[model samples]
Target: MPSEQVLLKPRLAPMIWLTETSAPVCVEISDGLRRTLFRRMSSLISGSLVGLIIIAILLYRNPIPAFFAWAAVDTILVLFRFAVIGRLMRILRDPSLRRPRDTLVVDAFIAGSVLWCAQIGVGAFLCMSLGDPVLAVFGTMLSTGIVGAMCARNPGSPRMVKLQMVLIIVPYAAGAAMGPEPWLWPIVLIAPLYLWGTISINRELHIDYLKMLMAQQESSHLALHCSLTGLPNRSSFKARLKAAERNASVLFLDLDGFKAVNDQHGHPAGDALLTAVGERIRGCVPDPADVARLGGDEFAILVHADDERTIPAIATRLIAEVARPYALPTGLVVRVGLSIGIATRRDADNDPMLLLPEADQALYEAKRAGKGTYRWFQPANDADLSSQVRELRDMLPKAQTVREHGFEAGLSVTRA
Candidate 1:
């Protein structure tokens, strides 16, 4: 199978087992989630800064020293978060520098520590009865939202999610456990349930995400490729032509006896022949050169070349290769001839539309001259020949009915 086909195949989840050898799909998902983490972290820091200011104001008169200490700790954490965000922005610019798991771990630890410290200092200042429950409830809700967002953003790594959740929940749980009041002990029980629900939701979201990725891959592949031959279709080929730099060459090919093959053997046999021809053309081209099926028996190849001389050499090879016999599934061998036309960016002034029409005209000339040959596009003579051929085709009878006849020593054929 071709590498393109392999790329279209659905990939397994890389997070099932954490390893350094991750797939490209997983890496892409991780990078996207890492960027999302930066946005979430920014929101979190803003909220934290506001909460710290409000808490400092509330405790300004009664616990002046404690306010200063808490404010100092929060300022340091905020600065560190800003630094991490700066590093994350650098990672966004250069994806190779991404270390999302480590960054997330650091974030989780700092956030958890800040929450724990705030609960301890504020709970003591306001008396345990009111402060402990308020802090516990708020911390639980905040942790749930943070952990849920992280999971939704980066569901490819369950281990990362687990580590973050543990760091986020443990400090708050520990603060509640170590509280001076006995009534606050029940708050610790909520942590495990919250963790379970978050994990379950993460697992489901990850599964759905993988399904979506697979569907998208399949759709994109189908849109750009020929379903019968597994080659790039006409639209893909034209897109490639438009993207090519100067001095690029295009070969337009039409099978000479393809209609006869379908008439003699069957449509299935014709399909098999086309598939084999597509593969053979693909084999003849070098890396970066593209082969595409332009509907029916017409095909196109785009190749990069430094000069005009390279075009004929490549076209010659294609002509020889495409004339080879194809083995059909019904234990019969069939032969087909290719008529190829060459066009280059130099000839078409780098216009894809003009380049294709030029190649089409050349192809018409090649067919007019004889089968199993190639021709370079010449706008002067070939354009008139192409127009005449189109007129002849239009004047031909639309339908023809043939009668069965006995085998004869000689056969006669005529154009419709």
Candidate 2:
């Protein structure tokens, strides 16, 4: 029931409970709601089987046509709900249908759950009104158990739980009040008080859970993003690149004259310059080509085929934007030049991993040509990319170590 604890599960929901909106990246159900549904399904099946046993015992003791009729209708609804739960569980696991069917699946789950509670309430009413002392006690115990389970199992929105609680208790209380026995009147008052108590307990648990979830998400955000520039970190860049399209391109950017700013204006001014430079790079590119700050003065961007801009045009725009003078918080106007290396995937069958080395090789060439310029990988042909990649790998060795933790260990570029 824990949502994939992985860092790359698309957009982090602002608030997952009590409210829902269109997902910006992909449709995702919260972990808590999934857990609650799973428990509900399990409890309902077990409770229904036990209830059938009680109904059978009552019929054997003294045959009642009215009791048998009620049981038949109740049993049919219980069986139908089992089917609904089964289908919903399967739907929740389907990745293809997530975007189109997520809202429908969750809504169906809620509707089925509410109806299950209403079924319990209807039975409670019938049993209490039957004028049989044994049956009345049996129904009261069952209703109380359902409410207790609801209290323990529910971690979804409080509003949905509140609606379910009312459905479960009100009908039973009304039936108890209408009973011929004077002793049954006490149950009517007690039922409302019981509901109030359960809701109070639920509220406290929910608040605590929300606080914990928020803290965990914030921690994950900090780990995957650069603190100075608020851009994705090197690890994040590697993750995104691994999943990039076959026709994607990689760009490696290094800041020229960055040390001059740090030497003259101090580290604070250098920090401000980095932040400003990051913003400018981000502004130069549109969707599908995100920018990442890959440690001091080095940044990378993944330009997928879906982006509107070509690799050369995007690189040119990045160089131009980053080279502009930046006014720091220290009131110093400092400038930095950008050197870019471009590597575009030539074929759909090519391995995406090769793009990284090629981009780095091109960046080296660009720096050699002179700072503040961009260069593309000039292979003899597509066949030469493999041999070049092997040479690059040998230059910086490590096989298994490099692949672990999503390619963060792969690169070893020594600045000349």
Candidate 3:
């Protein structure tokens, strides 16, 4: 028989701890804190088991009702601690409850409900067995109130801190007021332990909030920056352009023969060319002069030139930079060229979009002259070639035979 290969799936780390009666531990929190929480919870459960065994042996030797009553109270709290600690860990571990908003509104409510129910139940059990209905009922009610308040103010306000403080005191008050003999000792010890747990949860909430704020800041920063070139994006560019009150010039620079680079050398080479062009443009622009990737194969530069003469100089630098040879990934060396159109603020147009059209027209003239050149828009230049005629001329060869069937020449075709 031929052997069949079976793919084994990687298992997720278990969310619950079986030793502490299935307590939940949040992995996203600090490793040291998580380790401490885990160690303490585990150790407490282990210690509780040993203590119960010792009590069992003592009870066998001398069957005292007071001792049994104390043991019963201790056992109840231990089980309660196991359940609450387990539930708290589970709630924190829950991916949904990691955010404070999620914890306050959802997890806290659930934890409070469970604690309240357990308190009421335990109180009723003690009342029925120990013949002390007053202390049992009062203590349970206090616990229920404290937990309810904790849940209500769980949103990390001053009120939440105050409620948490009250909760810490409740255990002590209940311990002190409870009838003397055996039950008193467990109550006193349990109070401080629960207080420590509350403080731990509080610190965790603050740390989570701080992390969330940092993440939000990082996302905002990335949105303002271009992912490819690490330059300010078009939106940020527009905002900066509007803010500059100084007389400035805008140059719309388009890479000449970029489409040919993509066709001959593949997109990876085209991308490398674009990144190199971006770097060259960045070098061309001085500080306080901004550049942006307007879109694919096109970039814009806003310059605060020392003099109007600097425009031609800057454009010449850009042309020289781009015309240099680029080493492609295929080990093919290629020359990349650029066509830039400069439009000054002094030029009659006040509208930014108007500058674009004039700049675009000048760019058209530069491309027509051949690659690796710059052109400034001139009012006296009367050459306005129709785009439709240029497009039709491109399509004519493919449809030459079809045109022989019925088409008549009505326009003069010129190659650009």
Best by TM-score: 2
| Model 3, runs deviating above 4 Å | 1-226, 347-349, 379-416
Model 3: lDDT to the true structure: 0.58
Candidate 1 Cα RMSD (Å)? 10.3
User: What's model 2's lDDT at 156?
Assistant: 44
lDDT of each: 0.66, 0.74, 0.58
**Weakest ten-residue segment in model 3 by summed lDDT:** 1-10
Structural RMSD, model 3: 17.5
Tens-digit lDDT track of model 3 for 116-215: 3343333323432343445444444444344433432332232234333454355334544454546544655665566556655654554554356446
Please count the clashing residue pairs in each candidate, in the order shown: 0, 0, 2
User: Could you estimate the TM-score for every candidate?
Assistant: 0.69, 0.79, 0.45
The collision pairs in model 3 are: 24-89, 24-90
The collision pairs in model 1 are none
Reference-based lDDT, residue 142, model 3? 42
Off by over 4 Å in 1: 1-131, 153-159, 347-349, 381-416
Predictions ranked by lDDT, top down?
2, 1, 3
Clashing pairs in 2: none
User: lDDT, candidate 3, residue 279?
Assistant: 87
User: Could you tell me how far off, in angstroms, the CA of residue 327 lies in candidate 3 after the best superposition?
Assistant: 1.7
Reference-based lDDT, residue 306, model 3: 48
